[model samples]
Target: MMRSLGKQTVRTHYQHIVAGVHDPEHDHTHETRQTVYERPDGTFQINYMSGKRFVMATNDGSFECVHVVQTVRSASGSTIMSVIAGAQSLAVNRLNAVIEFESGDRWIEIEDDETARLAAGLTQTAVGHFYHEEERLEGRHLRRWFVLVGPSEDLAVVGKVALFVLPPHETSVDPEVVDCHIAGYRNGNPYPEFAAEIEALAAATDLPITPNYMGDPVVTPPATGRTPGL
Candidate 1:
């Protein structure tokens, strides 16, 4: 009865028992955080903590060229949220940026000087990109302000702003904007010092001055996390 271990198979499993194969759970780590919540129907909801990365697609309804970290299902053996390092867009990253922001609270004062400087540069760059469009009478100044805030700066400000590009579906934080604002307050920035520029430039045009107000609240980041010494 020991004739053979042969044949109807997806591949030659015995022959192709090699490293770096197509095993989805191969690199899965034990560090992945999982939390279970009991529903009224006695069904359990599980939250799987995974890092952010770009995803081309998934069998689930979530389909995007970017990695998506969502609390959708409670399946313990569900697919891991894998993300590509150095992914292009932070807005679409599959990371728990809010958690990172909360973790970063311990270092806020130390980081923002540099973070703010970078944000200021992006702010200046955005101003240039919208110059021609501003002449076309398009307003969304806050949206324009958000263009290059990156994960640290702008994306954290997503839900707290009057004009937010992304929806408020997940728990997140924008360290860049808040940090930069803090840096500006501690140091100096033409953003607030010369905020009147936006108002002046917008008076004869349709640009909004609300983005000018973005500075004040930024110094005091939202109650998104544990803001140390504040």
Candidate 2:
């Protein structure tokens, strides 16, 4: 006798037939026993010892069978070398912007601006690079400035300036330094407009003037010009 079963009914009928013939005490020396797995996606995976096989039923009421041969082979020396070369090439292509200062201190720029901004809030000191055009009589020439906001002592010497903070906003870039007062400078020099305020604060705390030099090359700003509501 022969009978056809629907997709949903096939699983139940198949399980019943398989259970009736399955041997629990079968020996594996000749061949491995069949194993059935019911997937959550309403699919059955039947495994055999010889090779891999997949039986799939499609929505068009057709069955597709795939047989994959499994083989084990040792890696050759050339294959291992090729894999290492590919890994090295991938690493070189994914390198990020990093800076090493003369004082042996290194600062790696965060890939994301928002993440960098959040990180800056956890520290009392921060350094950033900004692009601004000083409004001079010479038609506003663009200039790149490195900003440092930290303790007076750290700012006083170029070798001590270690903090590096990426600006948050893309356009109106500004580094956020928390609980820091009486410190703000650009290109290792105190802001000209805030010179009086800085001097007063320094005098009160006996802080020395920061050197007028940055020990490393000026960092290029990621973007130029100001944007509203970035």
Candidate 3:
């Protein structure tokens, strides 16, 4: 040891310490609906529910916008059939194919294959039906109607009439526009009384009416004497 005193060595010891800092609680209920952003590219994107960004795009670098006016979901949240049904209801029309006239006070409704497939996925019944009849000396009239009886007891009737516009004209209830206008019925029965509303809707969006008889005709009820009551 004395002889080795000329050579000396140094040693050091290091110890590590770890600790966690307490974090404040957050109120998730205070969170607001995620805002959709319009990108510089003229496209809109939103990350909604489960990290899915529903995107709408345009070919000309224009933005596609959509306001989700409604939503439906199953209690388990795993079954989105109701939402699909609602979406289909919003986008599909009464006349996806040719109309077949059936005679009777009761009409047998039939939907096109595409409409039927979409409707079938959401409900246990027909997506909708078509009723038609011919006049003695006049042309035939067809009415396409959809009846959606809600799980919450709400009832809705969706009707689309076909019309004839002149040459170089387009059909009313064109499948594309029809889907967007379908939301109009969500407020009330899409009947003759809603003609003004329909016309307004059509005018605002430049939607053309079909070239056939697709709109409801206004009919005034006949006057009658008051019935005697016991």
Candidate 4:
């Protein structure tokens, strides 16, 4: 599952490893690789890194070792459309929204009254103001949509979709965190990049996209399918 504050609170243990080697067969020549565990804390401490290359041989076979360390987070909010709508109510105008998809494309939707209202009240309280907070009120016109993703029954892929919501954003970022290691993978591996795309898209709009782990977005033109009115 994607790391979020909510999940971290309930289940705090997590481990991920990404390794790149020149040859798989040669790398696994040894019957076992050394495993070490040290001081466990909220932070990840890199125990070591190998600067020299060395070989080893037991009764087993010729072997080698590499040392490394990395950090991980176990934590997790918000909608863009409502913020746009609230901005409109605050007499802010000329807003545009760009939602980058998990696939390398974007779905752009123009906001109307209803859509703007959906997006408006979704903004957080501490951030309760565009210009200022004391004047804040809900039910402003704004546009909004949602994406829910989880493991599929088959367990090979993640399930995801984009849907419109009638309510304002009700979610909050989680506070829990855990240490983790991320392995390098193929280009298709979704990680930091998906989150990065959203950051770029947010720049196009007057709205602010929180820096969360939805990963980087793949921006493209807006979706082409029929969409319900805002």
Structure candidate 1, residue pairs in collision? 52-94, 52-95, 53-83, 55-66, 55-67, 152-176, 153-176, 153-177, 156-173, 156-174
118-151 in candidate 4: lDDT tens per residue?
A: 2222211111111121122223423243322222
Error of 1 at 47 (Å): 17
Question: Under the 3 Å rule for N, CA and C atoms, how many clashes does model 3 have?
Answer: 12
Q: lDDT of all predictions, in order shown?
A: 0.25, 0.28, 0.29, 0.27
lDDT of model 2, residue 212: 22
> What's each prediction's TM-score?
0.18, 0.17, 0.21, 0.21
Q: Residue 63 deviation, candidate 1, in Å?
A: 31
Runs of candidate 2 with Cα error greater than 4 angstroms are 1-97, 113-118, 125-230
Candidate with better lDDT, 1 vs 4: 4
Kindly give the stretch of ten consecutive residues in candidate 3 with the minimal lDDT sum: 1-10
In model 3, state the lDDT of residue 165.
23
Name the candidate that leads on lDDT: 3
**Tens-digit lDDT string for candidate 1 (21-62):** 443332211111112233455433332112222222225422
The TM-score of candidate 4 is 0.21
Candidate 2 per-residue lDDT, tens place, 1-230, comes to 22223222111111111223433332111111123344666665543223434445547544444322222223553333234335533432343424332333222233343323322321212221111111121233222122122223322212112222112322222222111222222222223433433233334333342222222222332332332110
What value of lDDT does candidate 2 attain over all alpha carbons?
Answer: 0.28
